[model samples]
Target: MSDAPEDLDAWVVTLADTLGLGADEHPIGLLLDLTRDAAHGVTRPAGPLTTYLVGLAVAQGMTVEDAAARTRATIAEWKTEPSEPA
Candidate 1:
């Protein structure tokens, strides 16, 4: 089944707020950037809104594997060094 629109919208909003940016910005992208830029692995209290987004995604017919894969891709993007323009 396709993912629920409500769940996706809410997730984006919460993520945007957490990053102090507009919802138009990609939260997953920001998260990956933050994690990659951090000197050490960091863990902070997950905003209640973020927790809700995760649960919402699961309920919206997203498999854990699907969610995990997206997360991994975002992280991998961050791990790669940005190429400088020649």
Candidate 2:
């Protein structure tokens, strides 16, 4: 296995191909930004949970791009709202 960290995209593509999933159709940068927004604007666990919801939406026949767009919009709205102190 290659030890280069820059090869993460290649590794992700390979894993997606192995699983017969369509990762190449989506923009990695956008996904990362959405995840970052979810984590920071909402909560740490929200990042993965948001992504998981996007996946579920896609599985239910929504386009991946649309799901990402919706998730980002939701995060934007979350950022505008005030959060209660933990």
The candidate that achieves the highest TM-score relative to the unseen native structure = 2
Instruction: State the lDDT of candidate 2 residue by residue for 1-86, as single tens digits.
Output: 78564586788788788889866654667667778889998989999888878878988999878998888877787789855657
Among all candidates shown, the one with the greatest lDDT: 2
**Cα RMSD (angstroms) for every candidate in the order listed:** 13.4, 3.9
TM-score of each: 0.32, 0.72
Any runs in candidate 1 off by more than 4 Å, and if so which? 1-52, 81-86
- On the 0 to 100 scale, the lDDT of residue 23 in model 1 is 56
Model 1 TM-score relative to the real fold: 0.32
lDDT of 1 by residue, 17-86 (tens): 9977665644454443444433232223323333344446755988645654664554355357543447
